[model samples]
Target: MLGGAGVLLGVAAAPAQAAEVSYATECIPPAAAGLDPVQGTTKVEVTAPATAKVGDEVEVVWKFVQAASKNPDLIDLPANSVQPSGTLKAAGAQSGDIAMQGPRENPAIAKGGAMVLSDMKGKLKLTTPGEVTLTPDAYAINVMSTDTKCSPKETVKSAATINVTAGDGGSPPASPDPTEGTSPPPTSGEPSPSESESGSAGGGGGSDTGGSGGGGGQTDFTGKEVAIPYACKTPIGDKNATSPVQINAKKDGGSYDLTVQFKGSVMDSPADIPADSVKPSMEVVLGGADKGKVHVEGPTNSEAIKSGDPMEIPDLTGTYKPGADGKSTLSPGVLTVKALGTTTTCTPTKSAVSLTLDTAAQEGGAAGGSAGGAGVSGSGAGGSGGGLADTGADDGGMLKALGLVAGTAVLLGGAVFTFMPRRHASRKAP
Candidate 1:
């Protein structure tokens, strides 16, 4: 009697098993809650081109949920946890995009970190044309800048594991997939995603037997909100001080206001360096990305550093919004600097300036550590002439160079023409 009941249940549940995949999704920002995510989940489903047959358009799905903490610690935050989930389609359709949806950054001063979203789906594609079989392997999901160390097209690596192999019963492996940890071997790993979607211009109807193939293997969707772990990650009180430190600069330490240039390089002499140490050099950058529109000033909007003394830039704790007219007043002891980034109201208790002095034997470097006991080695000394005298080339440096070249060329050409013999043919002898 029990056997009969079990058979009846199995038959009834067959249709349900064939339904599309679904699951819960939990989004996270590592420390936003002052604890690891205690309850969350993420669901993933795959889509393929209509033309693909059931066998052709393979898909995969993943579902996850965060567990509540039963621990007694003020709050529970788990790290390095794993919740395994999989789908048949995910394994079959290997030559396509794989993606994940969410992550968010929290700006709470009490709990702030980098906001980031891991879109694992974008990385799927065919390395070669045709049906490329995908297999599970270790992978990473990462954010990338326009740098040489990353793949431009795929930003997310959805599957850190894959398994692709022929299964018995006229179908691929069923639940508890045996192909775990292995993927169909790729022909070559040289930047495979670039050419996967367009199909082979060089070959036809090739078998994705061991690689990527078919169409619409990947999908793109909004990335889940996530905070970058390192965004504004510097410690609250850390200071970034520069070299050839000045007190109050005149005209932002320049010839005029709205144009302070800090020469970021220092002259170095090996003779000045101790035999036990390496000569130090300046490689610091000062000024804004749009260096033309920025200037230095003390509290009260008094243009330039008139004091010729070191200024202690306080932490900015208020909102600072620059007016359309590009003018703002600095609170006393707070340095007001306008640049291209977001308007920061807090004064920089932590300031950074590039030192041009030789670091020959200077202890604690501006880079390796603090500026403590560091020497700005030069006879030119502080206020030798002016603090910011060699800070940097003015924003007008490029324009000046161009003007000089053009003027010199014009003068030289005129002189050459005047000195050359003029042919005054004798009244056109013809």
Candidate 2:
């Protein structure tokens, strides 16, 4: 969870005021588990700037006062297997819920033992100027593949309030104007000189194949020079890095198939990164007509990268179905990279829309909804089909070793049971 705090720190420029509050929370297990709800008292300390100007990005931190307890089932949990996410409701000046996510942080915990949960952090851009009250809202705790959602049992009175002031008129814009001279020149009977130059520049941009037109009338954005600013955590410490991204989308029946290509970057590492150990997942924020987020995942690096060598990131892909009609815009949100058993998370500092498209409303329920409330949605280390890799040994050898262990355990169990006495049947009374 501290990894997430490091990512948010990159966006903050000044010191912040903080307040601590405690409340009673009730948590319910997933429907499939068919378990009763549990109640617990939790304390949290919220940190945020007391004053901020409009359009200025500020960071909000939520530190858990103590580690969370294990579930009622008392199942043992592995290291880096638990993650926490929640919403912070804002009222008065700004009135929307902000989603926060923390990286997986915890040592191996035995049954009924305490589970270490990381602190949650998120960033919000001040849109209006006034006093905004931020109250703690609902949250979800994910252990392995199961999720337990929790909320305040009673009304939350204690909160953090910030006074937002108007920004200076001279502050630079957070994003590039989409209508600026970014469009390609029109094609005529013969290509104009400017058109030829534009095409040449697009071709030499990067690894993306510059073209549009895929099956089902798809739009491709290959070779587009769009650099997204990200606050990243590396092995050494927290660092900011920007990398170009390629996005393509096409309407598939009532849904859309989106493909995102992240041209990997080479970053200096203090320690060597093992092969097939790095996995990345991204959360794409939806705006305009639709208001939600979509989760996308990428494959792991195939080879090992030595210390100080450049690391490579693979492309990501996911499917999204529109819930409402009209035009929608897709923007990159948080980026999570896990390497060498340690999780590093990154978030975009500024707004950058990857694509905008129009679609009709769906008749049924939306397939992919936002995982959290606003901002980037919280996701596990391995979402969907993506999980950690088995390193060091071959698959066959690992299976054989597991079989040997199982066989020895069975023999030991028989030896112990041989001397144990069996229970006699109970007699019924007339």
Mind giving the per-residue lDDT tens digits that candidate 2 earns over 328-357?
666666877654344556676665565666
Clashing pairs in 2: none
What is the TM-score of candidate 1?
0.23
Q: Evaluate model 1: give its lDDT.
A: 0.20
Which portions of model 1 miss their true places by more than 4 Å? 1-41, 48-258, 261-343, 350-430
Taking all chains together, the TM-score of candidate 2 against the true structure is 0.38
Winning candidate number (TM-score): 2
lDDT of 1 by residue, 179-261 (tens): 33333422211121111111111111111111111123221111111100001111111112221222211121111111112
The CA lDDT of each predicted structure is 0.20, 0.50
Clash number for candidate 2: 0
